[model samples]
Structures are given as C-alpha cells and as structure tokens.
Target: MEVTGRRWLLLHADEPGNCPEPSTTPDDYMGGFCAFNFTSGPAAGKFCWDQQPDYSAFRESSFGHGILEVKNETHALWIWHRNQDLYSTAGDMIYIVRQPERCLVESEVP
Candidate 1:
C-alpha cells in the first residue's frame, strides 16, 4: 500500500528499458508478481519472478469499490458501490458472515 521507488520497481521492471525478452516466447505484458533487490538501489534492471498468464481476466472484471464495516459483535458488511448507480443507491450489500475465535498474541503484542 505504501508507494515508493522500490514498489515501482516491482510493478514495472518489464518495460522497454529493462531486460529484453526473447522473441520465441512473446512475454505476457500484464501478469506476474516480482521480487526486488533490496540490497541494490535504483541500479536498474534487477528483479525476478515466475512466468504468469496474461492478466486480462482480473483487469476487465474489476469495476467496483466497497467499504468494509464491522456492524456488531457477530457480523460485518461488505457493500460494493457500483458505478452506474447513484451514491444513494445501495448496490450489493451482504452480511459478511463470521465467527469469532480466540487468538494467541505474540510476545511483541502488548
């Protein structure tokens, strides 16, 4: 969530400036997660990741924003606000069904 130069490296290492891909295996432009070289700073062209399918499926279908609300002790809500509907128009509201359970706190957790 925190945007920084390192994040940018991971997001965009396959651009025209970085490593040139082989023509035999035409690279999928919009897929794959990447790893950053933490030890190196803005040295350029230093990242790695496994091959991934073209990410058209996730991109085309994503079209809504939602708010996460903790209603009460036993329930929460996720309401997706669609683009077509007005702000007042409740698009898709659902009770985010949950069951509370005990959690073990780490030594660092006060």
Candidate 2:
C-alpha cells in the first residue's frame, strides 16, 4: 500500500466521526490537508497544514467525494462536489502543480 511521488492525498469517510487514524488503506485514512516541502530537505518545511488552510474543504466527512483530472505532468485539476450540489457543479476546485525538477532527487528523476 505504499504510494510514491504523490503530491496530493484524499481522505474520505463513509460515516460521520468515524474517521480512523491515517493509514495506507483508503478506507482507514482521514485528516486535514497536509503539504510537505522538500526544498529544504525532509526535516525542514515539513508537515504543514496551514499553508492552505482553506484546503480543508476536501476533508468533508460522510458522502464526501472528488475527482482529479491530470492535464499533464505538471498540472492537474481537482474538483470536489458536495452531495447537495448538482453533479456538474463543483463545490471546490484547485489546480495541483507538480515540480519534479525542484522536488525530485537526481536519482529519482524520470
């Protein structure tokens, strides 16, 4: 269940207040938004939840859902639609940017 080179992680819960501790398993993971900046190494600029506080919109519990469309290697669209909204409407949308040149090590480069 290991995931590598992933810039975004989504956690969805089926029952309200039933979110278990974070795990590799999708059904057991739940948390607010977390961003890790490797620009300064693993220990520096690590585990930041406040960088985009509003990104918490993705952490909605119970019937929360989203879709991710990768436009290319560097850009992708993330759309979160609430249960109350029409399927064509987006409750929240954001662009995910990947900086492989800046984030990946020489050996990890593709």
Candidate 3:
C-alpha cells in the first residue's frame, strides 16, 4: 500500500489486505473472514481487523489486474498484476497522494 495523501499522510502496506468477502460460495476462504473498509479513497475508514463481516483484498492464487495511475489532480498510482507478469509487472504497488487539508471528519470515526 502507498498513498501520498494527507488521508494517511501517505500510506504503505506489505500485505494482509484481507480478502474473502460475502462470496457465500465458491470456496469463500473456507467459509469465513470478510472485512473491507474504504468508502471513498485514501484508505477511507481503514479496516481489516481479524476479519468476519466482509472481505476482499487479498491475492496470490494468480490472475490479477488492478492498476490506477492518475499521476495528477491529486496524484495516484496503484498496481496489482499477476497475469504472468509482463506489462511492467507488479504483484503489488501503491502511490496515491491527495491532501485535502487533512480532511478526516467522518463523524470522527470512533
């Protein structure tokens, strides 16, 4: 994880993104764990504690695609490719900077 934004003053993560949401089927993480919290952006609410309500942010079984490079208007850069890895190749990348004057008053998030 890497977001150059006041939302997190620039973030970073090595893994544990958490996955296995309400799939409710197709071998959903053996049938359990799901916790995702990122409403808008910049790691919105930031979640993934223990896991149980909902999840979907892990990858490793191969086949992947998730890259966004705004590079402007606030700055952005995210990658997550696994399709054999070739186009630049990126198993995991991040870089999203956006500091809206340090805005984080979502009800003061308890």
Q: Which stretches of candidate 2 lie above 4 Å from their native place?
A: 1-44, 47-62, 105-110
Q: Write the per-residue lDDT of candidate 2 for residues 31-105, one digit (tens) a residue.
A: 223334434532345432223344244655636589999999678999887787665678778998867655452
TM-score of structure candidate 3? 0.27
lDDT of 3 by residue, 36-81 (tens): 3345554445543333233356537987789798987567999887
- For candidate 3, the per-residue lDDT at 54 reads 38
| lDDT scores in order | 0.50, 0.55, 0.55
Candidate 2, residue 34: how far the Cα is off, in Å: 13
- How high is the lDDT of residue 27 in model 1? 38
The lDDT-based order of candidates, best leading, equals 2, 3, 1
State how far residue 46 of model 1 sits from its true place (Å). Answer: 39
TM-score, candidate number 2: 0.44
Q: Which stretches of candidate 3 lie over 4 Å from their true place?
A: 1-58, 63-70, 83-99, 103-110
Ten-residue region with minimum lDDT total, candidate 1? 30-39
TM-scores for all candidates? Answer: 0.33, 0.44, 0.27
lDDT of 1: 0.50
Whole-model alpha-carbon lDDT for candidate 2: 0.55
